[model samples]
Target: MRVQLFSDIASGAYAQKLLEIGEGLLGTDQDGMIPFTQQFCHAVESEDELIEKVFPNMQQNIVDENWLCERTILAPKNETITKIYKKILAEINTETSVYNSIDTVMSSDDTTNYPVEFLNSLELSGVPSHKLELKVGEPVLLMRNLDAPRLCNGTRLRVTELGRHIVKATILTGEAKGDNVIIPRIPIIPNNLPFNFKRLQFPLKVAFSMTINKSQGQTLKVAGIHLGTPCFSHGSNHSAKECRTPVRCSICKRTHHSLLHPKDANSSEENKTECVVNSSEAGKKQQQVLLATALVKTICRNGNEYSIRALLDQGSQASFVTESTVQYLGLKKTGFTSQIAGLGGN
Candidate 1:
C-alpha cells in the first residue's frame, strides 16, 4: 500500500503542482524549498527537520496569530518531527474558486468556450500566447491573477481517485507539448454499461485522436501521430497528423523493410547498384521512401471513370502490378473490345 501511494505521488501532473506550491510557499528566487523538500522527502536522519519546515509554511498561511498562541496550531519550522500533522494540514487546504462569474470555479462539470478571463490578464510579458494552457473547470485557488510566471500552463483540476476525474489528452501534431485536460471521472457512457458500479474510480489513459473541428483552429509546429492504422482511432480522419508506423520501402510498397534492402526488390540489377550505395545516398533513399509512403499518391485517371477490361492474370502469382500489364488489359479484345485511351494517351 505504501509503494502504491508513493507511485501515485510520483505519477502525472500532481507532483508538478506540489512542487510549485512548495516553491511558492518558501520563496521565489532560490529554488524555493526544493532542497529542503527533497531532503525532508528522502529523510536520512528522520523527517523531524523537514516536517518542521514544510508544515510551518502552511500553518502560517491559515492559522491566525491567536491559534498559534492557544497552541491549537504549532508553528512549523525546519525542525519538527510529526509528519502526520503536516499531511493533514496539507490535505485540508481550501479549494480555489473564481470570485466574479468572469472567472469562477466550475459549478457544473464539463465546460466549453468558457472565456479565460483570468488567463488573459496574466503577467505574460515574455511568454508566447500559444504556451498558455488554461482549463476553465480546473480547480485552482486563483493565485492572485498571474502575479508571477506560472510553471504550469494549465489550471489544476483536482480529480479524486474516488471522487474527481483525471482526463488524459495526448499532444496532437500542433498542440504544445505536455498540454492536457482533466474531466470528472463521473462516467457518461451509454446506459448499456453499468454506471453505479462504484464511485470515484478514474478512467485509465485512453489513447485517442484529437477532434477535427479543434484541429481546424491551430497551426501545429510538430505532429505527434503519422499514419495510424487508417481507422483505428476515433478521430483518425479528423486528425491533422498521421499515426506512427514501421518504416517501409517506397518502390516495393513493402512495410517490412524501409531502405529497399536491395535484396528484397525482386529485381537483381537494382539490388547490385544499391548494394554499394554510399551512406549519403542511403540517407537520401530513406528520406524519399518515408516521404513517398507518407504522402498520398496521386494517380491521374484517363478521365475514363472506373473503366475495366478483361485481365488474364494466368498463374496464381506470377508477376507484379505494372503499368504495362494494366495497359495490355485495357487494350485486350475480350469478345467485346473498345478503344480506350490510357492514362497518358499511350
Candidate 2:
C-alpha cells in the first residue's frame, strides 16, 4: 500500500534532499563523519539577514493568513525565538494587546517561600509565559491540548479577535484548518519542577517564530532556522549537525564547532586522541547514567559556609560525601566499614 498523497507533498528535489539528510543517509562523508553538506544548505551572517532571507516582502503579506501559515522560523532556544517574534511583530502595524498571568503557589504555607514574582519569572518548557503579547491577525501556537483533532498542542492558529479573558483564533494547520476556535485563560501546572505552582494564562505562544523542537511534524512551505546558539540536546544535535558551514571557536581559534571547544584545550585534545585510538576496541555502546544534583551550602567545623555540588539519591538509605569535599569543609569523620552494593548488585 504505497501512499502517493503524503509522498507527493515532498515531491521537490530540494525537499527530498533535506528529508534524506534528516534520515542520516545523504549528507555525510565516506567515514560517516565530518564536513557534512547538501545542495540546499544556505548560510546567513546576521540575525537580520536571516530573517530577511526567510520572510521576504514581510510588510506586504504580514496579515495574509495563507502566507503566514506556510512559513515559520525555528530557533534552538525560546529566548532567541522570542527575539525573532518581536522583530517580526514590530514591523506589522497593528494594536498589540498585553495579557498578564496570575501566578500562585499550590500550598499556602509555601506562598511566602515562593513569591508571585518568582513564580511568574519561571519560563519552563511547554508552559506559557507570565506575560503574553498579541496582535490581531498574527499567528499563535496552542500550548495545551484543548480539543483533540482540532485544538491540540503544536496547532498553529491566526488571531482573529483578542479580548481580556479569551481569544478567538482561526486554525491554520491540520484537519481543522479555517476553523475558528475560542481559547480561554486556563490554569496550567508544569510537572518538571521541584515545587508546585499554578499559572492562569492563555495556553498560547506567539508563533511567528518557535523552538526547533516544536517545529517537528510540521510541513511548511518556507522555513528559516536560527542557529545563534548551538544545539545541545540529542534530538536537536542530530537535526542541526548536517550543516557543512565551518564555525570558528572564539576561545581556541580552531576550525571546529563552538560547543566542541573545551575549557582545557590541551587536556581535551589528548583525551580526544586517546578516544580515537581506542575507537575500534570499544565496539559496545556505553550506558548513560543520569544523576540528580543540586548546589547547596555546607557549614564547616569553623562555621564557614561553602557552596558545593551534591548528588541527590532518593532511593539510597544512606548518604555519602566525597573525600575532597569533606577535606575542603574541614569536617571530622568517623570511619566505618560496611558492605556496599555496587553496580549490578555486586
Q: What does each candidate score in C-alpha RMSD?
A: 24.5, 15.1
lDDT of 2 by residue, 1-346 (tens): 0101122332445444544454466555687643534446567779898888878888788668889898889888999998999998897788999999999989899989999889989998888999899998889988876776577777899999998899999999888899998999999987788889999999999998988777755667788888778766555454434555465545554443333322233345444311122233357432222344567987888998899987754223346888998799888989888865422233
TM-score of each: 0.16, 0.61
Q: What residue runs in model 2 are displaced by over 4 Å at the alpha carbon?
A: 1-39, 233-346
Range of the 10 consecutive residues with the lowest summed lDDT in candidate 1: 142-151
* Clashing residue pair totals per candidate (backbone < 3 A): 15, 0
Candidate 2 lDDT at 274 equals: 16
Span of 10 residues, lowest total lDDT, candidate 2: 1-10
Which candidate leads in TM-score? 2
After superposing candidate 1, which stretches have Cα over 4 Å from the reference? 1-44, 62-86, 90-185, 188-198, 201-346
For candidate 2, give the lDDT of residue 64.
83
lDDT of 1 by residue, 17-52 (tens): 343342243344564223435423333343334334
For candidate 1, the per-residue lDDT at 82 reads 21
Q: How many backbone clashes are present in model 1?
A: 15
